[model samples]
Target: MKNSAVRLTFLGGVNEVGGNKILLEDFNYNVKILLDFGINIKDYNDQYDRNEVPNSIKELVKLGLLPEAEKLAIINLYTDYHVKKNQDSNDLETNLDGIFVSHPHKDHFFGLSFVNRNIPIYTGVFTKKIISAYYKCSKTSIINNYGGLNWKLFRTGDILDIKGLEIIPVHVDHSIPAAYGFIIKTSGGIVVYTGDFRMHGPLAAMTQDFLNEIKNTLKILHQQENKRGEIQKPRETKVKLLICEGTHIHKGAIESENNVEQNLEQLFTKHPFDFLLVKFDRLDWDRFRTFSSIAQKFRWKFIITEKDAYFYYLLNKDEIHESMKNPNIIADDHILILTQGTVKYRWQEKIRQAIYKEEKGHRLIKYNEIKELDSGFFFYITSLRKDVIEKLNPNFRGAFISSSVDPYTEEFIDNNRTLSRFFRKIGIPSYRVHASGHAMPHHLINFIQSVNPEYLIPVHSDQPHFFKTFFKNSKIKVMIPNKNDRFELKSGIVNGSGVF
Candidate 1:
């Protein structure tokens, strides 16, 4: 490879839905940044059970859970405490500047806990809070601790000059708040990476703002280049490459969050259930807010698991998106913190104190209290709490709403089946009311067309071929990269079209 070339290596998120680890190396500028170093959920589960996950980074790398240390070539990326235990290998060197995390999702930032504490991890301001809240609430696992490392926070519209690369993080609408897509200007060319996003989300306008910013960046790049060279006619697109996620590319326009709310309300009204049990992704604050609002609307108490309560309490402490902030989770009579198990972690005790100190009523609703509830309650539970629900002994008047994505993996499929059987045994009718976090196929196509990059590389999808098919008539060259595939981009063009 030429020293001036910009190289992109797909280490993980290829032909998969998550576990996105992309390495971008600009040797000309001496800039190396890994975008979204997250573990692929299925791959991680396949390698080891939750109870048997390795704590050491070396062990994880040996098991192919992380990028190979030799290939990364970044020294001090892992703490000496983790790598020094095994003396067979020499220490890795450094040119790696930082790992830019796009969001707080486990599939995007879970692996940070295993990284070296010295390397700076960049994340949005609210994204950092959510990740830290996750770490504080959960057991100190490799994924949860996030390595307790150096964290540099940035908000939308911030221009981060890491070495020579200029990374502009623009907020994008995903399932979670503080999700971002980046416009990175390298010596070779401009590379636009669309971190997981959707157009039909509640905050779809944020995604549009990101798209507008990309166009503005191209104009800025043109203005800067015109100063040194002959004035050339502007092309429709100037972005050298675009890396995007196609998690739901096979499906056409999915339902919007508003549609989800409408469907959920319909279900609630149709059933008129005395009490409700709801399940959603823990970090899905939008869905949590949706349910909580409905509970308040119905004059029912919104009950959340202690874990959810912890996140809600933390998020409420700061300024965030207006639609997401809710003082009710901690202060209102309409909210209840459901505590079934004894407090195990120190964080749980802190949560207990926060709730008791802030809320006036005896808001801690125990599992036994749930059984005695006659009506007017919305109990939120996580996947691990299905057994807890069984213990609650819900009445037949209760309904279960699975307000999360449908199972896509084998393990999740099996778990869903088990949950279904349990729901059946409990004699409560179950409903699936959810909106996907990813963009629909049509929206994704429109987004790529709008960006109009010289080359388009699709990741975080099982059906990558869909991108090729959709872009065949367009000018975009859809590059389907496999795991660990490397491509050299020099002077705004790929050196070779064929796989390396």
Candidate 2:
């Protein structure tokens, strides 16, 4: 590691969409920071062995989920090498400087559970709350406990001055709220990392605002090159590298959330049923809002799982009523169905009290009342409970909307095929409706052009080469970065070494 070069190492987020682990090294100032250490959600141990999970940091590094940081300047909280209790007093501020998280997605933030609690982790406020909720509620072991981490909840424009590198979180719209893209000031130049953003969501303006800020910053840097010291000279003027996500490159373009929202209203109006069902992804709050808006517009009742109801309230506190906010403890006698069964999980016992009450007249309702009604209401159901599919009436005309990923992929097709058979047997019809949360090809091109970086490295994409073809003969040099490829950035020229 030389003093003049800045290094960008890709540990996982290449060729595949998740399992993102990136290391950003500032050799001149002896600073090392990890961007995101996340395991792929799609590759989660749903059908596999839970016993295979690593209980310690050494196992994590061995599994390639995290990179070895012994030579790294900072201390890691989770790893044996950097535990505060074992460290000598003189070597306290080891090599690692800080860790910046883009969002709370499992692919980006789940790995934080294994991170050294000593490292200063920077993220958004809402993202922290969501992660805490997820860790507390989820039955899956993949979501490690986040109780021990050192968190510095950075806002939209907060600049993180770690050593000599300046990192800023710029808000961007995604499936989950409080998603962000980052602008890092390094010795090589300004580097922008887009952490899974889309320009068609409700907060599309936020993404635009990020681009505008980048443009302004680049303009400012281009105008002045401070020659105060040799140390400061290499870092001055304009952005050198743009590390972006191309999730939708070859996955086909999708309409914005607005289109999906309108379609949902039309679907509800066309087929009003006794009990409509929709599969739920806990983090997909935009989808929840879409259904909520439909219920409000049609004057129909909408209910959600208590787990989801909590997140919904967090997202829509302004729209929800204060009276509906109750401590989710000790079930009420009024909740007939939720009380009938002996609930084992703490969340299960409190779910009825948490989600059954009326909120702003439409936010929360009970399953008992909805099933008794003749028609005109739908409720959200968790996919974990497969028995729920069996409980639907065979003669009912209710519709089930699969707003999450369709059965197009191999992993889901069989389950969905079985679900299709069950739905057909029951008389409840299912509908597929969803809008992707990633930028489309045209949108990607527009954003790339707007930032106008000297070098472009695509991450979280299956077809990174598509970017090369799309931006062929353009000013942007598209480099398809591979896994574990250490990129040394010196004067904006990126050279790679296949070393850990």
Candidate 3:
């Protein structure tokens, strides 16, 4: 075994949001762990022209999104387990040891195809099922290859000793099911990583459980250290570092949960239009479930696409089956919404072919299974995407319930007058309705008080200075690490300097 020093480097997701990659090196065992390998969507969109494609990592680095090729090649690369793009090379390629996926969110875990096939990927049981379903539906050839690949699905609380590192996946509340925050135990100390979480609805219980578990673990460590001899130093019990997310730090305080709920209810009651198109993030299943419950209560039929429905069915197959036994369940009221693009075109062509066969007297009859829609209030729940909304005509009145953080810069807000005007002409209302996934400043302060980590390192946001405001009088040193910065951790003290 080596000494008790560990070095951590933040390749991306420091000052800017997205592309979250952190390299952890345990000098005691010569083991390295890569946290999340993700791409900055904004950076990708900025670098690529409408028809152009980037060919190499060199191009990505030149865009100032990723690390230098030489530095990235040092450690094995592992993504959190999302693979949004079909192409394999869209993410960084390396000889990965293993991938510890938090959930099946496209941004968090979609780049798994970039890693070598031999490396094993670990995730929670529900997350594994979701990822498998996604891969099956997408029919990704890269996923099909590698002889079906290795997947180790562990329960939420199980601890694994991986290459001398004790890794524990703690379940957290997020929009998606089976989301996790990892607790990594090294010679240096325990490090808690909050993947993405919110404190609302069904997830409140899970969040509390997580806090309890961390507290218990710290207590146990303390007891063990206490039993040691007097001459021997007492081992630190508290986490040496807390890798917290600051996604909504700059936004400051957010609306209270009760206030947000009241606001939404008021909006729904006031907007008695023909159609109520509620556009929210698709992966936000809790919000979707809330909307579904509301629709059922109002006797308004729930509408969704066949693909989306299928995915939901896969996710909640047992619940659907249980609901089927109840006579009062209104399953038929849920309608399938279809678009006039690729899927619609293909379906129409198939229908036409069947109709033609019937006309040829082939003893075949054509039957229409799909129900025709006349007019009703339709809430289009989705993330705000202009191209998707353009497919629908002006006949349908809709509003966008903005759930995610708006990526608006001061310059764009001041100078881009035409953008707002164009959006108004497009018939989609943008309103902030939902709470954020990442913790706000108050929530962060609460979490810090609960966990009481010795040191805090904020990541996955632009505003690290906001943490200082919350921890102004505390003894726990709050660190704002820069890109390529390395930290030496030993006995609850973190000393580090920025690389650039």
Best model number under lDDT: 1
Task: Give one digit per residue, the lDDT tens place, for model 2 in 97-154.
Answer: 6677888777887777666556778888777776777765655442355665678887
166-191, model 3: which lDDT tens digit per residue?
Answer: 88888887656677888888789888
lDDT of each: 0.77, 0.67, 0.60
Model 1, 212-302: lDDT tens digits are 9999998877776676553576544388889999898898645878888788778767676777777777777788778777877778887
Please report, as a residue range, the 10-residue window in candidate 2 with the lowest summed lDDT.
Answer: 327-336
Between prediction 2 and prediction 3, which has the larger lDDT? 2
**Cα lDDT for residue 193, candidate 2:** 93
What TM-score, to 2 decimals, does candidate 2 have?
0.82
Candidate 1 off by > 4 Å? 1-4, 81-93, 232-237, 341-344, 384-387, 393-395, 409-415, 496-500
Looking at model 2, residue 175 earns an lDDT score of: 75
TM-score of each: 0.92, 0.82, 0.77
The candidate that wins on TM-score is 1
The parts of candidate 2 lying over 4 Å away from their true place are 1-3, 46-60, 69-94, 139-142, 226-237, 313-373, 405-427, 498-500
